[model samples]
Target: MTLHTAIVKTEENKISSEEAKKFILSEQNGAESIFVGRVRNENSGKEVTAVTYDVHDQAVIKSFQSICSDAKSKFDKNASIFLEHAKGYVSVGEISILIAVSSAHRDEAFKICRYILEEIKHKSPIWKKEHYIEGNEQWLPGYSLRPKEEIK
Candidate 1:
């Protein structure tokens, strides 16, 4: 398969890089790019204790597939892509997102990896609530549902 995508429930399961690597590996690929996004200890001047990800599962999955397919069309058709995002409570240092891409060239591998990430950020229905060390939590602003042309 050229694409694999899922939303992993952080409470029971964690995103694994090894699995991503294994999935995207192919004899046809000459370059591999993997991106691991972790829940940071700080965000916007606050000490972040953890993060909770809420997802519209069906929409997110559909978007992931579309995004990966678009990336392949735009870059390399033979590219293999693996993408997974976390849901539920994710502690600091835990993974929030993982993307792995393998292609025939380094440039295509890198572009596909980055394209998947950026598209997910803008198009996926995933929300984040950050927990601060001072016993406060706030839902951060996510991507606008409006079309890009209509936003201005």
Candidate 2:
């Protein structure tokens, strides 16, 4: 199984779900599951104009690799994982993250894809600052990693 992970800090482009899907396509893997995260137009009832993501690139990459390893261990060792996250400004309705997993069966692919996304949200050191349409801005904290007992 192959693992591809990236933290893109450039504003030249956004995370592409198609590209991720294309990269994860393999003849050996019959099932491919994908999860795409997009910047919402509103958050907590406030209209959001954009979201700027700040990340410790090295640390996030390491965390992502570890997440992929965990997924492999928990799911199928032969599954392939592809994860990508945007590090700069993302406009409303734009893609911010892409996760793709391929495995021999649908169940493993689905579970691994979900697990990687959840881990990224909880464990990765990526910060997001939301810009409101009214010119207000605020940094939001992501959810903390769940304890071992909390994980099923």
Candidate 3:
């Protein structure tokens, strides 16, 4: 059975890797690859107190679906894609995002999981702010996946 891709909205909710795994697991898929992103305690020698994420839900979900579709075309069409992202303050070591991919083969699962994660980081309409222990905070610049010619 072909599963509908899941793009979970985790606003004010903690991300769960187990939940994502359960959602993507299937009898037909022999292999599953998961990627969990956690907030680190430090960045560039600065002590990180917390990290917060703000997302444009509609746009991000659209982009996520597009990425999933691209992965299905490039990889295995039968693969299941599951993605979840936190949308509020997350302390160090807490999960920030989860990507799970399941396919009949291990290679396809691994490749699609990586592709979904990279696309989300570089293309999604999600904004992140890093709060430092020194009472300073800065918004991180969003990376773009588009080519220079496509950027306005």
Candidate 4:
């Protein structure tokens, strides 16, 4: 069967920009929106050297599928897309995640791309281990799970 979209590949899989571009362009569409998540050199006030990503494998992939499925339902059509995340050690300038969406119109692509990226950040089971300048690293907590009811 022809894949409607791809939400496969776990933490061990690495994605390239070329792959994302190809995935988004394969289908004949008028427009596209591509979002690339990359590793930067700073987080909070710390100077980051690299970021190690980890995921609760099954949950991460499931979350990705749900995103794609939801987009299709909301948009009422299949969008050409590539959803990828990484694991192991990723240094600065490396791609941590990539999302590309192609639709008949730019609005659909942009809307879906934005929705996917934001939702993934808020909902995915992936965590980040950030390496700082002083030779220290720390694993981050998932922000979406913060109990707002307990914040008070």
Q: Which predicted model would earn the best lDDT?
A: 1
Predictions in order: lDDT: 0.95, 0.89, 0.82, 0.77
Tens digit per residue, CA lDDT, model 3, 66-110: 988899899999998877777778888988888888999999999
- Number of the top candidate by TM-score? 1
lDDT of 2 at 11: 68
Ranking by TM-score: 1, 2, 3, 4
Q: Name the lDDT value of residue 58 in candidate 3.
A: 81
lDDT of 1 by residue, 1-152 (tens): 87899999987899999999999999999999999999999998999999999999999999999999999999999999999999999999999999999999999999999999988998999999999999999999876888779875
lDDT of 1 at 108: 99
Ranking by lDDT: 1, 2, 3, 4
What TM-score should be assigned to candidate 2? 0.90
- Model 4: pairs clashing at backbone N, Cα or C within 3 Å: none
Q: Which ten residues in a row are the worst by lDDT in model 1?
A: 143-152
TM-scores for candidates 1 onward, in order:
0.95, 0.90, 0.87, 0.84
TM-score of decoy 4: 0.84
Cα error, residue 107 of model 3, in Å, equals: 0.4
lDDT of 4 by residue, 1-152 (tens): 11233333434556777877776674557888888888999888889999887777778778888887788678737677678778678888888888888877888889988988888888887888999889988988678676789786
The TM-score of candidate 1 is 0.95
